[model samples]
Target: MSDPALVTIPARRGKAARVKQGQIVKVINTHGDQVVDTWAFNADDLNEFMSMEHTRPHIMKIMPAVGDAMLTNKRRPILTFIEDTSGGVHDTIISACDRYRYKFLGVEGYHDNCTDNLQAAMGELGLAAPETPCPLNLFMNIPVHADGSLSFEPPVSTAGSYVALRAEMDLVIAFSACPQDILPINGVGHLPTEAHFSVD
Candidate 1:
């Protein structure tokens, strides 16, 4: 087992996480208040991208648990959940942070949105530039209300809790260490989070 420690990477504007065919990368929520909206695509084909619409239904309304497999739009396995200590891995509800959302949420000043990071990731991988969409918000706490409404809440994960995933394909994983100030994930402060990758 790898040691549990906080590793901080400088936030590059448009760089993605490029992992080889059989490598494992872990994104840790070192600080209790942070959210990371992530997406994955085939390293060779841009069309083969992660789809929340396809994934949400397959998960069968239950939030992702430890050891659950994440599927892509083509029904290809992307990543398998290896650790989920928070017990609040919300895969369906929270959308990726973008510029339009920033304006709508009264946070227009923050141009360095999640989409930028995703685009950067793609560029780094030498993949075709594609329009970004709603991404999977990891470590984010979005609770479902009794009336079926969703409310963003403080992170359920503590300072040291983390979620791990094993890549099932040669994937280009793009993530935005979400700079969301309007939401609670960053404690309403839009603080940056830490990330680390290692071969298992």
Candidate 2:
């Protein structure tokens, strides 16, 4: 259970939320089937945001374990993976949901998606949305097999499982409660999830 002081919200599809610096945000899979793709940026300087290309090598080589610190593109500590209750926080290898991805998934006509949520969030914050980049797929199960293949499978997290991150700086966190219906990441259907924020 999270601390009572934490603010919790049910993140619906195509919506976004922001977290302040030094705050701890916990994304909880309230139900068994939801995918949350996350991105972080320096609130003061939007240019210093999470970069998939820069982070890929670290994620692949150092594979973040519980309590590992995730560094920003500027080589600054961004967040500490404090708690992984379900032991399954994925990497940037899995592509972030977007209009093109939806097209490939045969859901091109769907109006809701993770990219929309991210753009919406940026818009709300008066930040311009740039070319889409790969995002960290929180709660998504993308296993790297010994043969160097990736498999998108049902999440290892069950209902009530969560991953907690303590912000190392003033981070503008953006996320989409992914509405990816064509993959097992969403259990074949899109679902809502809960996000909790704690300021210590």
The alpha-carbon RMSD values of the candidates against the true structure, listed in the order shown, are 3.1, 2.9
Q: Give the alpha carbon lDDT tens digit for every residue of 1-200 in model 1.
A: 26653235334233466666667667766666567777878777767777777776777764777766777889887877777765565555666677888888776465677777777667765665466755777777777889988777767776756677788888787766777666676666555665443445
Model 2 lDDT per residue over 16-114, tens place: 345566677777766756677778887777677766667546655424556666766776777777888766656667666778877876764655677
Winning candidate number (TM-score): 1
Instruction: Report how far off residue 81 is in candidate 1 (Å).
Output: 0.7
lDDT of each: 0.68, 0.68
TM-score of each: 0.84, 0.83
Instruction: Give the least accurate 10-residue stretch of model 1, judged by summed lDDT.
Output: 5-14
lDDT (Cα, 0-100) at 116 in candidate 2 = 74
What is the model-wide C-alpha lDDT for candidate 2?
0.68
